[model samples]
Target: MSERTVIPFGPQHPVLPEPIHLDLVMEDERVVQAIPQLGFIHRGLERLVKTRDYMHFVYVTERICGICSFGHSYGYSQTIERLMGIEVPMRAEYLRVIWFELSRIHSHLLWMGLAADSFGYENLFYQCWRLRERVLDIFEKTTGGRVILSACNVGGVNYDIDNSELAGISQIIQKLKRDAKPLIKALVKDRSIKDRLVGSGYLSQEDAVKLSIVGPFARASGVEEDIRMFGVGGYGELAEFKPQTSTQGDNYARVAVRCNELLQSCDIICEMIDKIPDGPICEKPKGNPPEAQGIGRVEQPRGEVVYYVKGNGTRFLERFRIRTPTSQNVAGMVQLLQGCELSEVPLNILTIDPCISCTER
Candidate 1:
């Protein structure tokens, strides 16, 4: 309806870490419509379910997203348990919560640093990554890998946190809380950061809901759909467990929500260390389940991931569907970018923490 030109946002861009292509229909300098293209990296993970045995396919399930590795494993295990009618050991429940929150911490920190990098705040980016190193160290101490810590298993976690490891994790979480203060100030309260993010590329709450945005993207927009609130995994037992929310629905508010959540993650980790009951961490399934179908949803670092599994009485399944957060949030990214300036496009996309690899897969 207005004078316009078409502009391409990315398949490879400096601000984004993954490959997500966007075709922007713009009116003068303002973007009017944004069409997102996914499926580039879709490797047919769902199709693989019919071939791999139920027990052996957990590894394939964990590969949904490298950053959300444990959540993937957790979701897969939960689905299988539902099929087999298995309630895992109580200790395993608490252990799953620990890893879930830890993954959340790592993911938020990684995004915080990337958000800084997007705005050209080099010093802040490096500082955030420095603090994130401590989190990775904890991950390595527990899971043996920094990024892809396949810490989850079918009935429970693969390992246990002994008394010594528990004490060490407690200390590290404390130090992280302390170090995060200055970074939070710079990212959350800094006028300059606010200047670029606040009121820029806003996605109204009603519209975000309409598009089904999840994770920090939705929470930052004042939607509280966190699975943590569902009280799964030792979360229900917490003395204080609540979802973090913000109303701005802009990049700054997204960053603020995550920074605050980093502290909340620290709180969760502390409680887990204190309240974890000593016992066996896993349970043995009785045998192969009969014809069954299960749906599992996990709150990944990016957002909620839904895995629908259908088992046909044998080792393999009939259908496996994974609805990744990035895919669900893709529609919102385009909506937010509409009418935004060329310079604001990159920041807008990054606000969703788009994991193209996970979405395409």
Candidate 2:
């Protein structure tokens, strides 16, 4: 009989950028069970709603997760807009979609780079990030920040990209589309990559639904559910919007799903540029928020993010809640870790793209 033993996975690991600990219970080289330990970097940002006014609280929300900062800001603003009954202009809604899609592309690129680094492909990692820099350059040229975009607000966006700037953005995305193909080709065709990821960490479609998994992880398992399909935040304008999916539900499938989504995001951005309307970007709120409740749901790069708010007819809110995708996907992560070779543990964890910042927040 093989001896059972436990090993600590993280809180600090060379492969991970964020702090997430896992207790792996193993028999020989195969993991039998895994227990996740969170709460390493909780910032208490949700509770700050009681102190910051609705207008100012958006900044706090933006800090919840650097990779998905705009999603948080937009979700909070959407909730506040609903509570205060503010109608944002059509142009702003389209602009939000553009930025959101850009964020998704950059996020997936970052994840691909990190995953490469996790498996010791340093050159591939640099190449992936070099491609990602172009996306950040687009953000800097438009939003003045690469990671944390503070442009989203309660009524609408804080800044506007002129038609000429939008054209430049469209051109940049075209170039990005062309430039990304080679790196993606490398990721897909590399034999070492396949040997490491293919057939490892399988999560069947049935188990995915049973675990209530969200985001790319779920989509990779053949779950075609994406909140963006609801057409919120001007996603409806892109009538051709479809969720990227893969049937294998393994680490390789997750990478392929994200890579396909990156291409899809580029297309979505270009389409939004072509179809965006001309109108005011924002509107002033009429009055103080009444005692009311509001909810905002958005599809972040990681997955679905939900924000709930309650107003008390004052600057300070009564309650605020955030349901981040990583937090919801913890069970799914553990499930993927079980019954896998211990050496594949880091790759399995990376497949979920765990954002501990969002989880602990």
- Candidate with top lDDT is 2
* Lowest-sum lDDT 10-residue window in model 1: 284-293
lDDT of 1 at 190: 88
lDDT (0 to 1) per candidate: 0.85, 0.90
Model 2, residue 173: C-alpha shift (Å): 0.4
Model 1 TM-score (2 dp)? 0.97
- Which pairs of residues collide in model 1? 31-339, 42-360
Q: After superposing candidate 2, which stretches have Cα over 4 Å from the reference?
A: none
Q: Candidate 2, clashing residue pairs?
A: none
At residue 254, candidate 2 shows an lDDT of 94
Per-residue alpha-carbon lDDT of model 2 for 219-332, expressed as tens digits?
999999899999876887886878999999999999999999999999999999999889899887766678988888999999998888888999889999988899888899
| Model 1 CA RMSD to the hidden true structure, in angstroms | 1.3
